[model samples]
Target: MAVQDRGERSRRSILEAAASVFDERGYDAASTTEILARSGLTRGALYHHFPSKEAIAAALVAAQSEALMVPEHPVRLQAMVDLTLEYARRLRSDPVLRASVRLTVEQSSFNRPGMTPYRQSADAILGLLREAERQGEMLPGVDLEELTQFIVGAFTGVQLMSQVYCGRQDLMARVSTMWRLLLPSIATPGVLMRLRTTPPPSVAGAEGDGVREGDAETDGTARPPVTPRAPWG
Candidate 1:
């Protein structure tokens, strides 16, 4: 049990370290030596848990998926929005994902596959939107899939823009502005009100339902085109 525990801890450490490295150095430039050094583990320890560098990168993304997924709160729709924005917040702030921000660009790679970080991210936010709509947080005419794409696109664009043109100070502000601009129109007032009442902004980070989602457009060969550029931008 102790050995197993150590192994698990080692794996987690590697994942966290990888996130840091990926954020700082990115996939193409990052090295296993750096990840090991960051984790304070030897190569043997890292290899015991993961087979290859690509596996480690994948593990890092999976870790981000686990850490940054949207929360399910008392008000379902706002929880959905809260979750979306929170993901936006983390993508902008978190180093591991900031590096993968490039992953947002090659839709062919993310869209083509068995499961990539961005796809999982898209699916998760989409699920929240669907739940919000089903529960009357959104009006009847809502198209959950299309709405999900709008959201995913907005997030992708925001992160990508910050990557390119951001002045380095206001990326967070930019992200929040995007969310504020989008949420008001997408989520219904009743749902929005209920969410606000249930979870004030202060404690938002502490609560969550622990569910993660994968993207809807990904199918291994090609991505489905469901959502257009958000009407907001």
Candidate 2:
């Protein structure tokens, strides 16, 4: 048990260090030596956990899939909004997520085969959009499939721009602006009115508290706050 626990810790440490290095230097430019130095682990230890730099990069890419929490909401449209807002919040603060974004965007440079993260993200959102359509939250004539792809593409662009321009500190705000523009086209008036562009205080506070995804839902207090942000100017 002790050995297993220590091994898990070592593996996590390597991944985190690799993430930070990848986030700062990108995949091609990031070096194993730098990752080793940042991880504070010996070469043999790193090799034991990750045989090669490509292996570590692949691990980081896979890790991205689990970094965002999709909260449960009575309204699936609002749940989608919360998922995006919460993801933006996490991207601003989580090194692993930052690294994942870097990996996903720059995978071609590294000769990686596919953008698995983007596909997975699109699928998750597509599921939500399908549910929203079933619940009549969607505006008339909305095509959930096209809308899902559009959203994934738009979010990728928004997050990339935010990262380049502002270090992602303004990501949540940017995502809120995105939601405001997109909601009118995708959601019914009633659902649109009920959705909050900015994350509610509970969600925002929960992010800081390091609560796991769905914790807010389990507590049954995931409702949007009284004063959601007005649309960006």
- Going through the candidates in the order shown, the clash numbers are 2, 0
Checking candidate 1 for backbone clashes, the offending pairs are 119-215, 120-214
Compared with the true structure, what per-residue lDDT tens digits does model 1 show for residues 1-233?
Answer: 99899888888788778777766655667788988899999998888888987777555555556545566576566566556555555554456555455433443222322446557777887777777766667767767788777777776676667667852334444554665565566666644433331122443333243321221111212322222123543
Write model 2 residue lDDT over 1-233, tens digit each, in one string. 99999999999999999999988888888999999999999999999998899898888888878855667788998889889877876777678888878878874556563758888888889999888989999988988888888999999999999878967767777887888788877777777777777776665555455644433222324543422333431
